[model samples]
Target: MKKIHHAEASSYFIEAKDNEAFHDQRLWDLRQKRDREAAVIPEFQELRNLASQIKEHTLTHLAEYLEQFEAKAQANGVTVHWALDAAEHNRIVYDLLTDHSVRTLVKSKSMLTEECELRPFLERRGIEVIETDLGERIQQLDNEPPSHIVVPAVHKLRGDVAKVFARTLDTDPDNDDPNYLSEQMRVKTRHFFVDAEAGMTGGNFAVAETGGVVVCTNEGNADLSANVPPLFIASVGIEKLVPRLDDLAVFIRLLSRSALGSPITQYTSHFRAPRKSGEMHIILVDNGRSERLGMEEFWYSLKCIRCGACMNTCPVYRRSGGLSYGAVYSGPIGIILNPTHDMRKYSSLPFASTLNGSCTHVCPVKINIHEQIYGWRRVLAKHNQLPFVKKAAMKVAGKILSDPQKYRKTIDVADAAIEHLPRFLLYSRMNAWGRQREVPAPPDQTFHAWYLKNREGKQ
Candidate 1:
């Protein structure tokens, strides 16, 4: 597959300015709410600092903690599995379903599963996998990937959702009412909950001390999926492990407040062991995370709680939308992490950001996201992964910037081009940056010229 550059893909999003503004407003609203919540807590920054320290400690002793967690979980009768990559993760889940003769499986919102493409992997093997989360289910039915990590359907308007329901669920065609649509989905999801032979959830955090997987959700889908079925599987990233159960107090305090501006999610459920007469499994997936740990400068990206406050605060993410990044993870963190995972595949991601550093300030874990993105740009350039057009532009810019006389002459020419050139000539297909944005005309005279003409005379 030809990878779409961030600029090219984001052009489609930019063309729909109205939709982009709507999306931007919604996310900014969440950002404002988060600010409100932070204002009330005198210890908010202290909590963030403590949480960062706990994550740092946990990651530093990750191997030891993982082994201890496995031992404890095994003692509690929860089978533990480790996957080195996405393929292994998918195979393990499929093997478990086949062994149990599971025809249907219900799953809560799991970005890890999406990362592994587990749904299609199982479906191709003749297993029915139903998404239990309301947002996830909507995307599943629409046969599309999520646009946002938290609000998966954020790109869709209410009318768009209503039309989807009308076509898929046979609901009233004109009914765009939120309460009615939710009730309709509620009525249908209950049936899937009962019929599923197995259920799966993604853990927000794994408590190493208690052999517990903690899941937080607003819709209670994670709890329903885990409890209704006889067999339960929790797919967790290796980075999700916290050393102690008491640490949940710090994490839980920041999670919803940062992500949705709520005091807490509606459900904060912890699974310590298998239910009586039921089977439980935990799959620990590394999938490049172990390698990421060794990267000194970039390793802190693992501290992310996935609250998505960075995305909410990112100017590029708000304007361009998540789909433009062309990766499972998006925004500032995605720009850094995606390239770290596979630079050849996602080299363009680092260029997607404006390097404003807003993401670092809003991060609950204090990932230096913008700085990492800047670092990735250098890495990509060293490897000669930069696009031909960008390299040419940079080469010319470098030469002009290095010479004062050349710079002034170039500026004069640019001002002339802006004033005398036709709009089509300046904003044509050749100009990637100008394709979706207006190129402001430079001032008619240079600052140096004005300084000599006016400032010197005034003096």
Candidate 2:
């Protein structure tokens, strides 16, 4: 896959904002209602705490839970595979399809697969893979990465999709009605449901106690994908594990409401095993998750339900847009996860956030997102990722702030500089603060200066 530069990414970010505002406004209204209801519910906060604890405990003993999950799944007639990273995960899935001589695959929306670039990998191997999720399918045809995990094509307008469908499916471009477009997509995608030899999905939650994989989808594509094909594969991150089936009630209740403001998704299917006569495969992908868990301060990010509530509430995310993060996972969760995978590859992600703490507040499982970003900055700095100018500036500031005499002198200089600063200098590209808003001019004198002149003699 070709990597997008920050400048190119920003252009897409601008497009995403214009395309998503309507849906975003609707989601915001629903989110306010959900927030009000959650506040009134006496147990909501307690449940969040419990969920956090459960996730912490589960992650601490991930090796054990994974072992138990794999054993039980295999015993229940499900084939389990493990991949150390994204390449291995993609290869494992591709090999399974090749062995079965399956050429076409119908997939439900799976960010895990997207992270691994599964569709492109398969297409390179001469297999046709169709994304059945409406949003995903739109992005697939557009040849763009999903801007948002839940709303894959949130960056695309109805007209944008209509254009793509017109080109790909030979539909009329003049008809941009969502209903007409959806019906056309339904007709185009229905053939894959019957003719495709394999169906793939991402696991929402894997129950360690029962070895069942639960998938939540509003479109019902996951259920259709799982049942229609003789060979079914579920690709999931290793962190998506709950201890038992009962725990799903808490997560399910929180997930949809947080994600799209729905009371519940239209479909929530649990696959205990495959079809009685067909094959079922589960690929447990680590892909740097274990490394992330090793970092105590950042480990809580594993608890994310991919609800995207955090993204919606996040001020930085709202303004900068999802593509600014430069990862498959975006918003608060992406900031932590992206750096863990490859800091050099995602060095820009953590710094992109404003550390506003809104993501942490909206998180269903209460992951401390802002703190993790702070921790990442420390880690990045320790590793010498800071720019030379910033390092020099910080070193000077630190030395001055640490000494009273130096600090007093620095303040005097700052007062003089503020008074004399030119407009061009204040608005220069070198200063990030000036990039967006104007800095206020300083007062005539410092408090220390005024106090000494006016009150020292009186005292």
Candidate 3:
């Protein structure tokens, strides 16, 4: 799949506007259902808090926890490998395949694998990798990045998918029924499962105490992927750890409800060791996450369960679309993660939001996303990476606001100009706000004028 560049991602948002209103209405309906399901749970907030605290505490002592996890995993007859970065992670997996003489692999949904671009890397080494998830399969055919974390092809319509499947799977384009297309895909994918030598999956939560890797999926694709293949490889970020097995319930409760409006995903498989004498491999990937963990303001982002609730609830995300963020993860989480990888590449993300606080409110983990965006602004300014025009404007504004005389003069001039302000000046390229809204004309009388008139002899 061609990696969608930032410009292309931004273009998706512009293109989406030309579509009918029904698309947005559908999203609104889905979002409302998600919210309603979340609201019915009386202990949702408490669960979020507990989950946050558990993650925070776990991360603080990550080194010890990781060591414990590795020990338990090895004890359970699983071979564990540590990768310092994406490149290392890919090479390790590829080497394992080469060592085993594996030719093909079937994989469940694993963002970490996507982050490492594992499939492409393996393919480059002459090993074919097939994505098992339906959404992922759609994206694979489209040659595009996953638009939504949970729903990889969420941006695609049934027609879009039908076109892709017709071209890739040779399905009949006349039959656009989802069930037919799904059955066709099932038949095609079944071959890969039977022939593939390895199964790859992403870990939702890795139990530190027992070395268990828990994978949640609605389609049971992960189980099929793991069970069908003799070699099961599970890749997870180091932060996806909890102290014990019972802790899984709290996260499981919040994850599916926030992700797809389900109380729980249909399938949650826990793999502590290989099945039927199959070899199990666990790869713990750092991939700049260790650096992100060190930054206090942005560290809370690690607590994300990849449920994508933050994106679904964000007004900006709804309008701009996931592609605009220009990262593997989009929406509120992407805004923070994008900058961490390459601040210059995603410089526009933090400022793209209205700071409305909706993303933070909906986050399953109580991450203060809005405040972190502000912090990123400060960091960018400190690094002198802010755009020159914005910096200069802020400087001038600060100078005027700091000087009472200049401020009063500017206010009076602004009040005078309002009577004759041009529509374009108030509604042009200077800001997007004016494009969608009519800027209220300044009050005819300044507050100082009104105060003096109303306070005859009060002072």
Candidate 4:
């Protein structure tokens, strides 16, 4: 049986108390850093506006741009392949690897691979996949999907990493020093870069004018992934495409500042063709992107550049932890993206927010994230995807609030219960709100009663 998102988030919140606090503070720190970085750029808002327009223009003319990209890539001596969905994307990757007779494949962090479930698909067919990105490697060894996109293992402490390394890499579990752990991982995986028969990377931006796949990484691992092996492949989502190389200026300015509070990524590699003697292939994957584009309320989501800014600023995401979303994408972005992929599995997500609008404010591409989340709730209710208990409760609450006399009567009854009822019954399993939060002490008197008392004399 699938546990609903509310249950999953509640369990994480209750059990990971230490991690929960750290996660909240740490992400808030990132949010602060983002604000500081944004403050320095005099044209920050202007860049965001330009980026949103560029994306909207590209998406509206997506077909023409994609065709232009494919043609340019082909002209640049690159083999271009298209996949309509995840299964096809996986198959295309598997065949390409098998064709090159690759046994051990070294890959950098590619959410596209995770979205396509490519690692397991290849492993089942006797391919050994090595994750070259440190965070990705940690999650891989632990047998978990990445918790956060930019920082995949952000939920874990250095101590947790020491334990994971001890179990897998035979390092000292007690020595949780960051430098020692990083060096240990580096020394252990260095050979995979040289020995692997092939390498793969995810594209951050695909330029249609030059037909180049641009990847941004802080670690420089993506560069090694693309250049080291004789056989190279880049898995790029179609939405990552921009019309011209110059248009990259706007996104390049905003991407890191919004994501990690850095001026720019350490490595912004552009790959147009294979190396002198090596071969290269690019997989342009739709994977439901085209269908999502047709959705009027949600099509703006495609403008996302995977910055994770909204995630950092989101109070619910910071407190609940990214894994609570139980999907490839998490946080505000996930809340909107997951439902379109699977309504039944992710219907609880839209309701996970406070509709705070903080996410919309922080978005580099200006996506109306909170409004979209609210829109999803309406969509879910219409489609009967909301859970039975919630549907019934909303119905009752609607009735009570619609008529003023009934509302006042219910409020009086609730005030009496909170004031006089036993603690056990007041906070029993039946009270969902009380489960995660303390119900405030009953007011000295109902506001309505106080208003009647004071305002009666004034009138």
Candidate 5:
């Protein structure tokens, strides 16, 4: 597939003014909710700082903790698997299902599985992989990717959801009621719970000290998926591991409040091992995380807890929509992560941000997201990865900026053009900034000119 840059994709998103405004309002509501929730916690900033410190300590000593977790989990009868990359992770999961003769699998919300493209991977081989989470199931039925990590269908309206349900599951065509749709999905999802032979979930936190995979969900889908099936599998990023149960406590306090504006998620389940007779497996995926770790300036990106708070508060993300980034993850965090995961395909992501730093301010782990994005821009420029047009523009700009005479002459010409040219000419497609917005009115005179006139004789 040919890849389009964020700018081009977002242009299409911007065309939907109503949808864009609605999307912006919805995400901003979540941000406001987060702020309200945070206000009640007297030690919120302290909690975030503690979480950051714990993550840093754990990541630096990650290998030791992984070894410890593996040993403890096995002792608790939970089988552990390590995957060096996405292919390995998918293959490991497929092999497990095949070995157990599992023809049908039920899954909860798992961004890692989405990242690995697990549903299509298993489905291609005749395994009936079902997404049980309401938003995920809706997207799965519609054959679309998640628009937001926490709220998967935030880009969609209730009518769009009703239409999808009506078409795919044969629900009432006229009813767009939220409760009606949710009930229909609930009744339909229960069938997957009963028929599926295996279940899979994504980990919110992996407690290395106790070898438990913690999953937080509002819908209780993760619990249902894990308990009803005879086989359970969890796919977790390497970054999800924490040093101890106490560290997990710190994150648990921040995750839901930041992501959903709740004190805590409704169901925070911990799976250490399978029930009496069932089997449990944990697949720890690297998927370029180790490589990302080696980038000293950007290693802190791994501390993210997938809370999605940064996206909620991001001005650019609010307007652009998640699909604009063209990656599994989106928003300020995605701008840093996607390029680090694969720079060739995602090199345009860093340019998606406005560098307002609101993302960094709202991050539960304090990842310095905006700064990392700025750093990635330098990396891209260093490797000549920038577009030819942008490079040429920068070179010309640099030349003009280096000489005062050239700068003054250019400013004078621009001022004259702005003052004399017709709007149609000045705001045409040739002028990139003017294409989206009206050209700024020309200043009465250049700042330099005014300064020279007003201050030259002051002494």
Candidate 6:
């Protein structure tokens, strides 16, 4: 597998000045809003703590809670299925759709289904899958993966969206008004809500106590997707389960505030059973989550609620774009999560962060994302998964740092190179850092030399 070259991939997003400027500022604005909303709530941090603890407890006792959830869901007239991996997850959904004679499926925004690549799977088999969420539908029409989790098409400007709609939805390309675009999207998708044979959703939180799947959205598409179709399906990641309904209060408070700085979503629909006289199915998907749960350094990442808080606050993600990660999940969370699934394919992802810890600080679940990224780097190095150049450089760095004389000599050489190297040599393509910035001029004197002069070699 070709390793994900994040720098090379992100160059495209960065080169687009208008899109890059908007993407960076828009996400940072959301981060500011998150901070403001968090400040007003006295118990915000406490809720995060409680939510983290609850998730830890639930994960440790996952089998018991899963069994309880299955029993209760079955009791409530919902057919519950389990998937061990992505292939099984896809097979189960396909079998279910075929068994029910479902030709067309209308689906709400579902990251789990995206992870399973369900749309392409079913479409290849001649089943039509329509995305109902505004952002997801735009991305689907564009034939691109979402650039951000909460705001999938965030990298696109209104003009770009208008262009997309003009090409596909046949909207007036000159009419780029937000309201007009939204209305056009609504008008186009309204029929699918009624005409589709099946509708699918992904749950934000699953309550083991009540056997209910909770979906929170600003748009009410999930509501329509779950309620309008005679055959309803929800694909839930196994990590979404909570021990009881009361535990929902903590996450409910944090999800919106952390994600979009809203007090709550416009619609927080709870699906406990099928619509009257309709059939409901819930697929509790593992898809490498069980393996992640067993990992010592990385398991707590499962505490994620899919709120996109870390992505909003991540400077690297804001600049690089989610598509740069080349995974269903992106940003800080993806750095650690993607490698677990395919180390060779995603090894470069772990090194894509600046380790600023803004993602961890902003995460409602307090995932310690930067630390996990660091851990992934170490693990990748140990497993020989790092790029050959990086691996060799790191090996040299390790040797130099282990010996004081060698380290000092290397620093001296670097200082000389910085001061005397010609611009042509220093700013060449080989120097990735110099692409966007010139290497800083050599210091007036090396810090090491200054230290020696001041302390008179006391050590």
Model 4, span 1-459: residue lDDT tens:
263566566575648888888888888999899999999989999999999999999999999999999999999999999999999988988898888899999999999899999999999999999998899999999999998889999888889999999999999999999999999999999899999989999999999999999999988899888899999999999999999989998999999999988899999999999999999999999988999999999999999999999999999888887888989999999999988888888889998899999999999999999999999999999999888866776676677668899767656655554643433323223356566687677666677888888997897
TM-score for all models, in order of appearance: 0.92, 0.92, 0.92, 0.94, 0.95, 0.94
CA RMSD of all predictions: 2.9, 2.8, 3.0, 2.7, 2.5, 2.7
Against the true structure, candidate 4 has what lDDT?
A: 0.89
> What is the clash count for each candidate, in the order shown?
0, 0, 0, 0, 0, 0
For model 5, residues 61-132, the per-residue Cα lDDT tens digits are 999999888888999999999999889999999999999999999999999998999899999999998898
What's the true lDDT of residue 326 in model 2? 73
lDDT, candidate 6, 44-150, per-residue tens = 88988998899999999999999999999999999999999879999998998999899999999999999999999999999999999999999999999987779
Which residue pairs overlap in candidate 6's backbone? none
For residues 1-459, what per-residue lDDT tens digits would candidate 3 score against the true structure?
Answer: 222344346656667664323335555666787788888998889998998898989989999999999999999999999999999999999988888889998999888988888878888889988999999988987888787798787666677788899999999887889998899889999989989988899999999999999999999999999888899999989999998988888899989888878889999999999987699999999999999999878888888888888777777676666666667878888888878888877776777777888878878878888888888888989888776766776677677668988766656555444633332223223345555577676777778767778896787
**Local distance difference test, per candidate?**
0.87, 0.82, 0.82, 0.89, 0.89, 0.89
Sort order, TM-score high to low = 5, 6, 4, 1, 3, 2
* Model 4 lDDT, residue 434, Cα: 64
Query: In candidate 2, how many Å is residue 312 off?
Result: 1.2
The deviation in Å at residue 253 for candidate 3 is 1.2
Model 3, runs deviating above 4 Å: 1-12, 18-23, 414-416, 419-436, 452-459
What does candidate 5 score on TM?
A: 0.95
